[model samples]
Target: MIKSVLFDLDGTLLPLNQDDFAREYLTHIGAKVAQVIDPKKFVSQLLASTDVMVRNKDKTKTNQQVFLEDFLHKIGVAREILLPVIDEFYETDFVLVKSITRRAAAARQAIMAVIECGLDVVVATNPIFPASAVRQRLAWAGVDDINFKLITSYEQSHFCKPHVEYYLEIAAHLGRLPAECLMVGNDVKEDLAAARIGMTTYLVTDCLLNVKNAVINTDYQGTLQELAQTIAQIIKER
Candidate 1:
């Protein structure tokens, strides 16, 4: 029996255009740190550091450590000097990014459905953002009120999405075999990768994000409304 359900944030639970979200996010953060660092240089180094985090496979360092190590090195700033500013931005200015995101009622319904079935719910968004930022997005999605089994963040994760290791880490955290967890998301590549480790998958198609036009091979595919009902049906049959 499935013991847990993993939900992706960006196009899955939270309705958003990934490109637009990233652009607005960078714009807001860029303005916040403009006084000390040039926005262009800051954005460049940030992207490069994010890439470093993406390619990171060294389980010893969390994605946050890898990102900061490369980011601070290239940006030529001390952690003490820059971290507070970024933290403050997430606390204050990051809310503006919500304007680009739409609230999905089905998201909360789907999560609640999973919870009511006594299954653990995980917000398995790509672990490239600080927890504060991820939580903010969760709030914007209207699903932050409930407790989660795990919320993948750069501080806690060593790998990013589309990497099989990321799924392994989450599975290890939940102490559930991959087969006992159901991966649900909108991305053809990132979220569906969980199937490689024996997990089942449900592709949320309301905001489908198959950018590469890859063939869909998920065990299931449907909109968020259907997902909630599907979970109910799955439990009933069990």
Candidate 2:
């Protein structure tokens, strides 16, 4: 039986177009840091650095390390100077980007229902951001940080989603097998990828991204309301 539910944040529980949200986030932070560096070049360098971090293979290397290393390499600046600048962006500029997201009452209800069913809850958002950023986003979704048993963050995670090892790591951390977990997200590529290790998947179609064009084959798919109803029915049946 499924005893836990893992959820993605941006496009899944939080209703926002990933591309538009990302563009707004980068633009907002870019404007703030532009006073110290060229805005356009800063955005370009930051994105390039992020790309490098996403592709990094060293499991021991934190996402922050990967991003910082690549960013510092491009700017040719001392690591000490860059830390304060990045800190300023996350602390101040990042808060403004929350306006792009929409809150769903049903999403919160769905999460509550899962908890009531005696299932463990995990905010399995991609471990690209630090815990503070993840906590901020959770607030946007009407989910309190304390609601989840564990929230994935760069400091505690070594792998990114779509990698089976990432799911395996979480499973091991929770002392549960993959088959006893339910993976829920709006992205076909990232969320559905957990199925390879035996976790059942529920695709939230409202903000779906079928990057690999794989959603057509998934049996469990629906909008947030529909998902809430499905979960309710499952609990009733149980």
| TM-score winner | 1
Candidate 2 segments whose C-alpha is farther than 4 A from its true place:
235-238
lDDT of 1 by residue, 1-238 (tens): 7898999999888999989999999999999999778888999999999999999999999999999889998897777878899999999999989999999899999999999888999999999999999999998889988899999999999999899999999999999999888999999999999999998899999889989999999888999989987886765543
lDDT accuracy of residue 31 in candidate 2: 82
TM-score of each: 0.97, 0.92
Clashes of each: 0, 0
Residue 36 CA displacement from its true place in model 2, Å: 2.2
lDDT of 2 by residue, 1-238 (tens): 7888888888888899888898998889788876678778888887888777767768877777887778888876566766688788888778888999998887887888898788898989988887888888888888864468889987778777778878888999889999888888988888888989998888899988987665354547899888887885654443
Candidate 1: which stretches are off by over 4 Å?
235-238
State the local distance difference test value for candidate 1.
0.91
